[model samples]
Target: MTKLKVAVIGCGSIAKHRHIPEYAAQDNVELVAFCDIVAERAQSFANQYGAKAYTSYEQLLQEADIDAVSVCTPNALHAPISIAALEAGKHVLCEKPMATSSEEADAMIAAVEKSGKKLMIAHNQRFVASHVKARQIIASGELGRIYSFRSAFGHGGPEGWSADGANSWFFKKELAFIGAMGDLGVHKTDLLRYLLGEEFVEVAAFVEQAAKENSTVDDSAVCILKSASGIIGTLAASWAYNGSEDNSTVFYAEKGILRLEDDPDYSLIIDYKNGNSERHSLGAIQSNEEGKQTTSHVIEQFIGSIVEDTTPPICGQEGKKSLQVILAALASHDTKQIVRV
Candidate 1:
């Protein structure tokens, strides 16, 4: 089997912490190159992974043998980099919050179609053990028609993840767009969509700059979504939680209420209407030398898609659908009214 050659753009925390290590672990993929505007950071990644380093994405895209590129760059650069890579005849795996706007996402989809190359978005929540199990339960009709629910993803701030802290692109409205909504909300939004197996029809959102001494964008947001299936839910995301990472989801159906969380052994709890409760424990994805776990599942699936010529679970269009919900929530926040998703 011919191994897929991968060039990862951007050597930031997400790239270093997840993408690079994940791609490296796949047996059929080679970490061919790393790129970052900060030359030294890219050099460091190259040294650590035994790959070449390039200061420019264009230079990396020029590699004749490169089969795929991961867009681990900031929000603003997502579309441009992915489009360029796709046009250069390489498959693209872009990080979530697919792009800053719907238009950029549309352009990316067009480019992917024109290039006839695979495009997958890194929505790792779908691969998490608990979420995968939750999806299974819903699909099995055990939930008995998911009617309404609520989900949240929150953390103290980007201090631990963003090297530049308040000055990080996450704090800048230009680069990161709406702070918590894009950073954290996008994940929960995507997870919700995947679990419900429905399309969000419209959104009404309330976003605020609730934390961080001074910031142009919101630090927290709560959104209400109406799905095409008539399911309703509230999605909350925050960077000002001032607590440990809180990622949880609850589903209320005619049969029961199902819940899942990151903590407490990563299990899904179901309370059925007959006054019975069930708990399903999920096995965690084994970690690699770098401690990267199931988040690497996307990399593995992407490589499989390359080899098998099949669409990965989270394809480019599926990614954009989730992004559209986040973008609509932002628009709703600005206009103070429900916006069509």
Candidate 2:
């Protein structure tokens, strides 16, 4: 088997913790190059992983004999970098919130079409055991028509997760584009879409910089989303949770309520309308919290898609659909009206 040579752009927290390590663990992947604006960071990862380092992504793409690349940069760079990688005949595993705008996301999809290479968005939440199980159960019609749902992803802030604490690019509007909604909300948007197998057609949201000092983008947001099938729900993304991370979701169905990641003991819980309850012990959801190094199946799936010459589970088109909701939410917040996605 010829190993797929992979390069990583942006040696930031996501690259260091998830992309690099995960790629290295794949037997069919060769970590061929690392790129970062900070040469030292790139060089350090290169030394650790036995790959060359480049300060310029252009140079890395030009020089490395790579089959794939992971764009783990800030939200603003996701589209441009992913497009460039695709044009260079490299498969792309771009971190989520695909791009800053729908146009940018479209451009990425167009690039994939032109390049004939795979482009997978790293929406790792969909790979969570509980989320996958929920999707399976929903598809099985065991939930009996989900009427509504509430999904949330909240933490103290990105300061604790980014490479630069308190002064991270995540706090800057220019670099991050949007804050909590882009950072956390987008994950739920993708997850909800995947879980219900439905699209969010409308959104009304209140996005505010409620907490986190020295931030130009939103620190808290609550969005009301209506799916195409008329299922309505709330999606909240916050950097103001202040306590242990609250990444959980609950679906109110005709049969019962399905709670995901709400309880530490059990990852999924289902309460039937007929007075019966079931608890599932799926593994923990991935977190940025210290000492919680849960595995994300994103890299494995991306590599598998490329090796098998098949479309990724979360392809460019799927990513664009999920991003539409976030873009609509932002517009809804700004206009103070319901926005069609």
lDDT string for model 1 (1-341, tens) is 67888898988878877888788788888887989888999898889878899998988888636999999888889999999999999999898888888888899999988999999988878887888889989999987888899998887887667646567788778887768888889888889988988899999999889787767788889999999989999999998877556778899998999988734674688989999988877765333223434465778877788888998788878988988898898889889899998
Residue pairs with backbone atoms closer than 3 Å in model 2 (clashes): none
Model 2: residue 36 alpha-carbon error in angstroms: 0.4
Candidate 1 structure, TM-score to reference = 0.94
Candidate closest to the true structure, highest lDDT: 2
For model 1, what is the error of residue 18's alpha carbon versus the real structure, in angstroms, after optimal superposition? 0.8
lDDT of 2 by residue, 1-341 (tens): 79999999999999988998898899999998999998899999899888899988888888899999999898899999999899999999999889999899999999999999999999999999999999999999997998999999999998888998899999999989999999999999999999998898999999999788888999999999999999999999999999999999999999999999999999999999999999999988999988887889999999999988999999989999988899998899889999999
Candidate 2: segments with Cα more than 4 A from true spot: none
TM-score of each: 0.94, 0.99
- Residue 336 shift from truth in candidate 1, angstroms: 1.4
lDDT of 2: 0.93
